[model samples]
Target: MSPQHRLTDLPATARAVIEDRTGPLTSVDMLSAGLNSPIAARLLLDDGTSIFVKGMRTDHRWVWTQQREADINRHTQGLAPRVLWHLTGQGWDLLGFEHIDGVHANYTPGSPHLPLVLQTMSSLAATTAPSSIDLKTMPQRMSAYVDDPRALTAFDGSTLLHTDWKPDNVLITGNRARLVDWGWASRGAAWIDPALWVIWLIASGHTPHQAETQVRAHPAWNTALVPSIDAFTRAQARMWESIARTDTPGQWTHHMHQAALTWAKHRQ
Candidate 1:
C-alpha cells in the first residue's frame, strides 16, 4: 500500500523536490487524517531512514519554530524522533521528522494508570535541556488559539515550553515517554508543558476534577496551575467562537461544541 496526498497546489519545483527527497516513493496511502496541514508519507530508505513530510501555511512558517523542535528532540536524548530535515524556501515550508514508533496515549476516564503517567511526565519535564529557544516574540494570537490564558502569560521569558503537550502529542512505549510536535514551543515557564498536558488530559476523557486534582499532585503542574479561571473561560469561549467560524459544518464540530459545554458545566 502507498500513501495518498493532495499537493497539486504546490509549485512544480517544490513538487519535484518533494518527490526527489522521497526518491522512488512509488505510491502513498492515507496514514492519518484530519491534520491541520497537508502531509505525505514516504518509505524509509534502504538504510532504515523514513520521514514524515508536511507543508505549512506560508505566513506562519518560521525558522524558530522548526529549530525549536530540532533542539528539543536533540536534548530529549532520543526520547523524541530525530528531525531529519527542515526546509523553508519557495514561499513554502516543509518539515521532515523521523517517524514515531508508538501510539499517542489514550486517557480513559478513571484509568488507574493516569496518575503514573502524569508523574512520569513531571519527571521528563524536569530534565534540563542544553538548547535555549528564543521567544522574545511569539505569535500574539496564541492566547486566542490556546484554551488557557495563564498558560500563555507564563510565557514571560524563555523556558522549555512545549506549548502543545496534548495526549496526541505524546508518544509512549515500554515505560519510555517521548514528546513530539514542538510547533508551538515557546520560552518561559516550564510549567507550560504540564499545563498543556492538563488540558489534553481533560479533553481526552478524564473529567476536569480528575485532571485538576491529579495534575496538581505533581510538583511541576503546581507551578503552572491555572492562575485565573476567568481568563481560561474567556479563552474557552473564544476557542468555541473560532471553531464555529472555521470548522466545516459536521458532526465532529457538533460534538466539539457539546464537549465544550460539557466541560464548562463540569466546572460549575
Candidate 2:
C-alpha cells in the first residue's frame, strides 16, 4: 500500500477540485489508513463542515476500489455514511463522504455494541445487490481458498455483503451501528455475513459456540446449512493462513488465523 498522504500533500489541482465543492478547507485531521487508500482524513471546510475523505493515486493498483466504494455507497445509506463527492485529478482519486461521529465497535463478549452491530448486519442482509452494477460474487472471491471448488456453490445468493467484518469497520453511534469501507463489498448468501462475524467474535474472546449463539438471532442464520457453514469456515481458515504467511506475522492477522481455524474445527 502507498504511504498515507496528508490533505496538504495533495497536488494543487486535486486540492482545487475539493475546494470547488467544499469551499476553502480550514484544516484536516488525518484518520486511519486502510489497505487500499493512502489518504484518509476529516477535512474541515472554511464554512465549518467536516467531511471524511479518502483517496488513492490514480495509477495505483487498487484504484478501482475507490470507484467501487463510491458506487456502493448509494445503496448503503443509514447503514453507512453517504458519499458527498468524487474527484480524480493531478494523479489522485478522492472520495468525500458525509462525516459520521462514532467509535469503533467493541466486539468483546457481552459488549453493548454487539446488538447494534447485529442490527446493522441484518439490515445489510436484506439489501439486494444492484443488478445494474457489476459486483464480484462470494464464490468468485473465495473459490481459491477452498479444497473443493464445488463447495463454493453454497455461497451463491443475491444479498449484498460487506465481507470485511473487522471491528474497526463497524462504528457504534448512539442506538445504531454503521459500517464503513465498502471497497470489499460483494454479492453473497445472507448467511455469509453472520458466518464471517463468527470468526471476528472468536478473535474478540468469544468461544466458537458463543459466537455461533450470538449470530443465531439473525433470521438468515437458519438459512445457513451445516455443510455450507463447514465449507466456509474451512475456506476462511485457509485464506487467513495465506494472509498471515504472506504479510508480516502481525498479532492481528495471527489471531484472526487462529480464530478461523477454531471456527472450522467447531464446525467439523
Which one wins on lDDT? 2
Q: TM per model?
A: 0.68, 0.94
Q: Model 2, poorest ten-residue lDDT window?
A: 1-10
lDDT of 1: 0.55
Candidate 1 — worst ten consecutive residues by lDDT sum? Answer: 1-10
> What TM-score does prediction 1 earn?
0.68
Alpha-carbon lDDT, every model: 0.55, 0.87
Q: List the residue pairs that clash in candidate 1.
A: 2-28, 2-29, 3-28, 3-29, 4-28, 4-29, 158-188, 159-187, 159-188
Output the lDDT of residue 94, model 2.
91
- Candidate 2 residue-wise lDDT, 215-242, digit = tens: 9999799988888999999999998898
Q: How well is each residue in 40-94 modelled by candidate 1, as lDDT tens digits?
A: 4544553455666665545743434555666566655555677777676666567
Native RMSD of candidate 2 (Å): 2.0
Listed per candidate, the RMSD to the true structure in angstroms reads 5.5, 2.0
